[model samples]
Structure formats: C-alpha cells, structure tokens
Target chain A: MRTMRLNMQNVCLTMVLSLIALGGCDRQATVSTTSVGAASGAPDAAPARKLRIGVSIPAADHGWTAGVNWWAKHASQLYPNVDWSIVSALNPEKQVADIEDLMVKGVDGLVILATESAPLTPVARKAHERGVFIVNVDRGFLEPVADIFIEGDNKAFGRKSAEFIVEKLGGKGSVAILEGIPCTVNTDRVEAAMAVFARHPEIKVLGRQPAMWNRQKALEVTENMLQQYPKIDCLWASDDDMALGAMQAVKEAGRDKEMFIFPGAGMKDVVKMVMDKDPLIPANITYPPSMIATGMHLCVSVLSGEREKIMQYMPRHLMIDVELITPENAKQYYFPDSIY
Target chain B: MRQASTRVLSLTAGGWAPAAALILVITLGFVFHGDRAYFNWNTHRDAMRQASVYGILACGMTAVILAGGIDLSVGSVLALVSVAFSMMSLHRQDSAAMTIPAALMIGAACGGVSGALIAFGRIQPFIVTLAMMVAARGLAKALCGGVKVSRYIQDADGRYIALPVPEAFSRIDARLLGGNIAVVTVIFLACVLVCHVALTRTTWGRRVYALGGNEEASRLSGVPTRMMKVSVYALSGACAAVAGICQAAQLQQGDPEDGAGYELSAIAMVVIGGTRLSGGRGGIGLTLIGVLIVGYIEKILSINNVPEYARLMFTGAIILAAVLLQRRWHPDSEGRG
Candidate 1:
C-alpha cells in the first residue's frame, strides 16, 4: 500500500513537469504568432511602426540549415509585430544579392548566416549603414557587421573529439581524418585536431579526406581508404552523419575490430551508440542543433530592450562549449525522439 | 559490301574498346593490388554488384532518350516507391508473401502517374518531369513524415528476423559470388534482355525508334507517338522505383532524401553512353558500359585517397569530356571520319 502511494506520487510529479513543459511551448507559440501577425500587418491598431526583419540564411540543402529555417519561422511566429522576410541562398554571391534585396526592402533588422566571411562583410556593413539590427549566426563576416553573433565553437568540438579518440586509443594509433564542407568551421576543427595530434607524434594521420558532409560520398571514400590502407586504428570524421557513413563502410568491409570512428555532432544515433559502448563508436562530441534556439533567444532579448547586456557596437562572437559524450555521460545527450 | 563490312567493323571497335579497357584496368588493379586477402575476387565482384543499381537506372534512361524524351523524375519515383514499400512493410509487421508484390505495385502506380502526365498533358517532358522531381520528393517526405524509417521485423520469439530474400534469387547474391551481388543485378539483366528484344524485334520498338528519328514522319505514318512517349516515361519511372526499393532494402531504411541528385547521375550516364540529349539514338548495352565506367572511376578515385570535392570535380570533368567526345562523334560530322 505504501509502495503504491509512492508510485502515484511519482506519476503525479511527472505529469506536473510535463504540463509545465507544454505550457512553456504554448507561450512560445503564442509569442511567435502575435509577433508574426503584427509584422505582416494583420489588424493591429496602434499607429504601427513597421519593423522589417530581414533573415539571410543558407539554403536547406542539409540538416543544420533545415533546422535554421525552422527556427527562423518559429521566431517569426512569436514576433508578429515585426515584418519578417527570409531569403535563403547557397553561394556567397547569391547571399549578398539576398542581403541587398532585403536592404532595398527597407528592413529594420537583419539576421544573416553568411555562406562565407570576406565577400559578405561589405554587404553586412551596408545593411548596418542603413541602421539595420544585424544578428549574425554561425559564420561571421570578415568585418564586424552584426551587433550580436551567435555560433558553436568548432575548435572546441574538434578538441573534444580528438581527446576522446586519444584516450580510447591509449594515446597512440594511426588516425584518418574526414573533413566537412570547406569553411571556417572545417578549417577551425582541422586545426584544433592537428593541435591535439601535435602532442603525440606516435598518432600518425594515415589519410585525410573531405567527405563534403555527404554520407554516400563518405562511404565510398572510406571504402577506398580501407582498401588502400592495411589498417586504420581510428577515423575522426568531422561530422556525425559522415561518421555514420564511414562506420557503415568499415562494417561492410568487416573491419570493425581495427577501426574506432567518432564524429563531432551529437546526433541521437551516435549518442545511442556511445551509451551502448558500441565497439566501433565509443564517443562523440556535442555540437547541438539547438544552437538555433540560442540565436532565437538572443534575437528576442535584443528586441525586448534588454540591449544593455547585448553588445551592439562590433560583432559579439559567442562560442558554445562542446561537451564530450562517452558511455558514462551519453544519457545526457540521448533524445530517442529528436528529429535531428 | 566492303563499305558495309567496314562500318560494322568500326561500330564493333567503338563498342569493344571500352569493354576491353574496362577489363584491362580491372586486371591491372588486381595484378598490382591482388592477393587472396587484398584485391580478391570478392572485391571486383562486390563493385560490379553495387554498380548494377545505377546500371539498371541507366538502362531505363537509355530507352527514354532513344524515344527522344527525358524523364528527370526517375530518381524521385525511386524515393517514393522505396518509402511506400518500407512503410507498407512496417505496417504489415511481416515480410510475408505480399510485401514484394505490394512494393512493385506501388512503383508501377508512380510510373503510371508520370506516364499519364507526359502522354496526355502535352507538356515538355523536361518541365513535366522537373515538376515531378519536386512533387514526388515532397510526397515521399510527407508520407514518411520527413524522417528516416527503418523496417525491422521481430519473430514470435522476439529475435529480429533476417532480411527477406526470395529463394530462387539467393544464389545470385551468395557471398561466394560476392556478398555485394544484389537481386537488383538479376532484375537489371532481365530488364536489359526484355528491352533489347522489344527495341530490336517488336513493332512497338521499331515505332519508338522511327518516332524518335522523325516525329512528324512517324505521325504521318500513323504511329501512336503520344502513347509510345507515355509508355517509355512510365517504363523509366518503374525502373527507378525498382532501383529505389532495392536500395531501401540494402540500406534497411526508407530515407525520404534517398536518391537525392541521382537523376542528374542517371542522365549523365545515359549521355556518356553515347545517347544524344537532343532526343533519340542510344541502346541499353551502351548504358551498361557507361554505368561500369562511372562506377569504376568512383571506386578507383576513392582508393587513391582523392578528397571528396576533388572527386566531384573529377566526375564533372569526365562528364564534360564524354559529352565533348559525343559531339565530336556526331554522325553528321564528317571531320571524325
């Protein structure tokens, strides 16, 4: 009878927590709706100051960009008073064109994820000159154009993955590298890993290949590397999805024993593999997709007149720390149900 | 008579050189890297087995090109069918007797839709199929709820059941023959045989060729040009669906994004196989060779430690070079002769 009473209490507590979570989501949604409606000029009757919000982002060719789109849309829903328009492009030139278009659209605020640094600086500066609120996410421009910058620490992600690999391999083994798309993120991570590798000359980098953040391509490339190299002790794939493909190739070749593959994105499957202490994939580094939420939160804070804390002069770069995910701590990162 | 013999000799030479080159390259790769444990028989066999999926798609593409129409929706159709098949299998909770047939039927249905649009709508095949490429992807994403769906069947005892393989087709995919030889290879070979017969022996095949050669003349001759176009597109779509299902089976997941950018590759393969993009004049045999060339090049590059971006650049260069070669080999150009 006592046990049953305790069980009821536990269930009730869970219900209350769930309700609170749901309530939070509801508030966010409501905020988004009103904000988006007001921005679009939907029947709000106070001599309206039309605040045009311009969103410049990368096209949804991959998962991270898709998440960015989702977050931007959600933010629009929350801030209905601001007129929001989004332009997504793949290349830097097109992104610059998009920014120029938004500038012409007379946007009051500009949120941009530049495809590159140098080419987009002038465009961002031009937008700033027009008195637009610049919120830069992930990739920053060459010059400081945005008042606030939000992004993950790619160098830290690389360092953590390298540390995990070194520990697992007992500080010595041949490691191959699979890089992401060529960019600041890719170069930073590679440099970070190389720094870690420098500490141990015994850990030779047998091969380094850019998988271009593609699974099939990575799979084929890894397969070929496996054929060429007699034994590869570790594979440090820069991203989780590419790592997954490399893992598949290793498995297909029946070389699971000799390989230890770890990628830096905290994708759910990799987290699961870490939790289970999967032989081939024993660790991963957290590069959360929820960084979009961080960007959205910053945008809200700035709009809500909490600008005293928000640096508005030069681009304020924010680097989120990367968490090492291993068997002991894998549960913290596991979301069996996350779309990412 | 002498001129006819010379022409036949040249045509054979044109076909056989690539074939001979392929054999020579594989032989060299084997001799240099060949050991019982290294570049073993299984390695080459596996490569060929995997290449068959693209080979099959190229075959269908070759046919559509011969009829002077392009179907860009084939890859999209494949994605749709794979998703539909996996979803159906998951819902049934069994890989029972009906699963394979159900998958095939779904593929056929998708093909039928694409065919109807091309044949009756009187739209440019490029435009119609381009719309299909997007719409089919949207449909697949919608059906699968924009997530990768894995199909795993558990037995009564709760152990996971082994993937279903038809008994008659098991030997073709045997590990000894190369664990990579998929049932898709057999299907592709059968498709090539049937298509060859239809193109060479059947009245419909001759009509297709005639229509492609001269559309207005064929129309004047009372050929059902519209029906043939529709049928060929439908056939292409079906082939894509088959490839998709096979791929999904191999991957053990129904990915909405599966076969992304595959249409471009298929088109490239067809064009490289010596098919004219302006419509008509190609065969499945050449497409097979094209698939082999592409598959071999990719395999060789990866083995050589080339970076992914460089590999893409290389593929693009090869494709451009092949197209240039085709232009140079244009029958009307007397310069080559």
Candidate 2:
C-alpha cells in the first residue's frame, strides 16, 4: 500500500507538471457533417419568362436552422412567377457539390448561406463570375462577392446582451458566460460581449466555456460553472437553447430564483419566458432564423423589374436589427407557426 | 522471484497505464483549476453521466473488436434509431415504451444488414459499415423530413413552454438518482454490467476472443465463427440503439444529426481500453476504463474552462501518449482499431 501510494504521488507530480507545460486538457470534437441535398418548391415553371432563384443553406440540424427552413418555404410561396429551388447542404463538400449542381441547372439568381466560409467562398465566387446574382445570408463568403449580404448582427447581439447584463447588474457583479461552438461567428459574439464586459472593470467573468451549441452540452457545462462559482449574479447563455439549458441547470441546482440569465435567439420557448415575464429570464437578444425570408425577399426585390430603383434604395450590405426581447416587444417576435 | 517481480512491476506500470494516466491527468486538472467546482461529487456524477453514451457503445464495440471485426455503422445506427424512435411511435411521441423498442429494432436492422453483407456476402467490414453509415443517416434525414425535433423546458410558473421539437422527446435524462446521480449513468452501468459478464463468463465469450485471435483456428476447433461475427455486429447495433435512446432522453428530442461522429469516440474508447484492434485481446472492463478516461478528461477541461480550441489538441495528444505507452508493452500488435 505504501509503495503504491508512493508510486501514485510520483506519477501525480509528473502528470501535473506535464499538464501545465502542455497548456491544458484536450476536449475537442466531431467534424461538420456532410450535408445531403434536399429540394423544396416545384421544378421549372415557365422557364423562359420566370426568374430562376436557387436558395442554398445548411440543413436544419438544430432549432435555429429549422426556422430558416420555415422562412425559406414561406417566402417561396410569395412569388409564384419565380422558380424556387431551396437546397439544404449538410457539409462543405456536399454544399459545394450542390451549388455546382444548381449553377448547371441554370439559375438566374443564387442566394447562399455557407456552412463554412473557406470552402464555400471560391465556389460561390465562381457562381458570381458566371453572372449569377449572389445573395449571401447568415454566413458570408470570404470575399465581398455577394450582390447583397443579409444577416443578424451577431457582434451587436453579443454587445447588447453584455450591455444589458451590465446595466441590470448596475455595472458590477460576477457573471458566467456560456459560449456556443468555437467558430468565427461565435468568436465575434463572445469577443464583442467580452469587450463590453471589459470596459466595466467591476464586472468579473467567473467562467466562460463553449457549450458546443447544443442544449445538453449547455446543461453539463453550466452545471460545472455553478459548482465553480457560488455567488454568480448573472449568466450570459449567449444562445436561447443554451440559455434554456443553463436555466435548467440553475433550477436543478435550486438556485433558479437567485440567478439571472440572458439567453439570445428568439427561440419560441425563451420568447414565451419573456412574454410571461419569467423572473430568471429578464430579457433576451434577437438573432432570428427568419433572416432567410428577408434574404429571399431582398433577392426577389433586386431581381424584379424595378431593379434600378431597388438598387438605388436598398444597400448592398443589410444587417437585420437585433432586438432585446422584454415583455413589451416579446409578442412580435413570438411566432407560433414557425418551427424554431 | 524475478519473473514475479517483473509481472507485478509491468502490471502496475503497463497494464494499468491508462488508469495511471487518467489519475495523473485528473490530478493535474485539479492543480490547475481545482476548486469546489473541479473537485466535487456532482462533478464526478455528471462525468459519469457524460460518459454514459460512449460507455454503452464501447462495451459492445469491445466484443465486436475482440471478434476481429470493426463496426463503423454505430453512429449511423444511433441516428437512425433516434429518428425512428421519434418517427415510429404512434401514440405519445416521447413514450419510453414506444420509443425504446423501436429504436433497438431500427438499430438491429441496420446492423443486421451490415453483418449479412460482411459475414455472408464477403465484403470488408469497413466497406459494409461505410455504406451503411451513409444509407442509415440518409434514411434518418428522410424520416424526419429534414427538420429538428423541437423540445421544451418548464418555467418558474410551472407552465410548459414547448421548444417544436420532436427534439423535446427526451425526458429520460432528466430523471435523477437522489438528485445527484443521473439515470443515464445507471443505464450505462447496466449495459457495462451485461457486456462485461457476457464477454468474460460465457462460452460465446471465449469464442469471440478466440475467433479474433485466430479465426481459422477457432473455426476448425468447432467455434461457430460466421454466426458469431453476425451476432457481434448485431449486438453492436443494438448497443448503439441504446445509446441513441439515452441521447434522446438526455437531449429531450430525436436529433437526426445526433451521434454523427460518435462511433469514432466509441472505437477510440475500446482501443484505449488496451483492446487490440487486430483482435484477440481486451475486455469490456477495459473499455469502461477508457470511457471513464475520456469522460473525465472532457469533464476536467470543461470545469477548468480551458480555451475551447485547445481542448481537442490536448485530448488527441493524451490519447496518442497513452496508446503509445500501451503499445510498447505489447511489441507485436499494431494496437489500433
């Protein structure tokens, strides 16, 4: 027993030293899935006269993208004269392949929301060079190749959320942050939020961890955060699904009434919390999945006969507003008919 | 005396290398980021909860690998089963009764086809499962009509707010044991128990190991090799189905996207457990250790709040280090899966 104990101690010392030198623990994960092609809307209709519009986006793997699908189909119905082909890609390779297929099928306009910026950029650029009217939504291409770019202001979403937390906490308190997946978009949101928190020296960030953009992951990560910090005043869950997960963890820890949570995205359930004025969730940030509809509508407007007037009036870069969902404006954002 | 001493020394140093590494890494974790959060009972309990899915999958994978075969279709089966469980149920959507059996069947059916192709049709296990992987995931997407199942959570008012999920279907993960231990952990333990017993005790267990060690020799010696191969793959499929069910329970919905790359994790666990991918060595108990190792590593880093990008690199490095150390103890085997 003594020998074993001695061995364990020696090993433990080496392990700790090695760990520190190595920088930290390793906890990474899965590759982005290869998306398959799925089509919505009818095939060619009056091919000669109608404007052919191809919509490409990521498959609805989570709550947010499901809303994208709902809006895409909804907008497809608005213009019967247009030939709409909405394709959802699962991975970068499949996305590139699907877009190539779309270009071959002869679309006059292509609206793409890339899965990853790097792979989709060149292919989208090729589509653009070929005179395709490119309308990029949510995720953008590497170059400014799109005729129009439309998205929720993620950085603003992050900044405004942190700003609200600062204002609510009177600019001083301990906060735990739950980040989504480690991506450029997620980084932009987090860094912007951190910048807001940085300006206020009084607000200390107790813990900030990636929740992998999933509800279950958020629950587990937040549980760890709760154990680490006993006196957390507020939690910036960043995303609604994450907020819901964190809220559950806090409640499971039986500190629901004590802790304040701010989860973004106008996910219906979280929106309902704002509508009901749930004590734990005082407010939320808006990053609606409905931006796809806005993109689709804009593409139609740009391609319509009034193109000269529309181009003069509408800007090439369009940032949809990020609203704070308090009890007052919660009703407008609540869409019962929408999937997400 | 010298031989015995070396046996003891090697057992301590090499046989338990993964365990030693696990403890060492965890201790380092506490040293770097330890506090109430890093060293608590709930943290350990949640660690087990997190490991549960891979624990379940790895247990069955140990058997499949011991039979000198690999099954890559586990992830696809997980996707299929989770989607089918949600889409197949005629009654209440989240009803455990309707969901569990249907998931298992779908998993088994996917496995059965792959097994048949590999065992009887004489295709490579890798090829068979690779095809099954894409086909199964495709079917899952088709079944869900390519939309995420919405799930829900309750508010302070005790009012139910639905999140459009067929994703809301998971309520199983919410069940707790004394408010600390997750029911998911219990499910994982039960699977480990059954797999461990069946792998170590039964005549079939011996056959599985023997076939993996030497299929031609085992077959000539009256072991039913072909039947065993099919059974192992089927068992793997069924195990994956259980994992899918648990994931749905935990996530509270059927995610067609769930378990997308989880098979690699399971295979990693089984391989780390000192199970020779070339077959003929290792057991389910070893896999449990691997699952715990990976689980604890994930938990430790998460609690420590390590920079997210660094997490993957550290995980890969340690997995490499531990496996390399384990390989030196067994000079001949590739020690890979």
* Prediction 2 global C-alpha lDDT: 0.74
Candidate 2 at residue A231, lDDT?
A: 90
**Residue A165 CA displacement from its true place in model 2, Å:** 37
Candidate with the greatest lDDT versus the true structure: 2
For model 1, residues B1-337, the per-residue Cα lDDT tens digits are: 3223322332363455335435544543443331121254434544555666677677777778778788788777788877776676555444535666766666666656766777788777788888888998999999988765554334676444444433322332234333434465677778778876776667777776766667898889899888888777767877886787666555445667777777888888776666666654556666777777776654443332222455566567656655655544454522244
Best of the candidates, TM-score? 2
Task: Give me the displacement of residue B49 in model 1, in angstroms.
Answer: 2.0
Output the lDDT of residue B17, model 1: 37
| Residues A202-304 of candidate 2: C-alpha lDDT, one tens digit per residue | 9999989989778899999999998988899999899888888898899999998777999988899889988999999999888988888888888887887
What is candidate 1's TM-score for chain A?
0.80
TM-score of each: 0.48, 0.51
lDDT at position B199, candidate 1: 68
lDDT of 2 by residue, B213-323 (tens): 888988898998778888888889999999887765544455677687788889888877667788877777677778988887766655533443465676666566556
Name the 10 consecutive residues with the lowest summed lDDT in model 1 chain B: B29-38
Candidate 2 docks with a DockQ of: 0.03
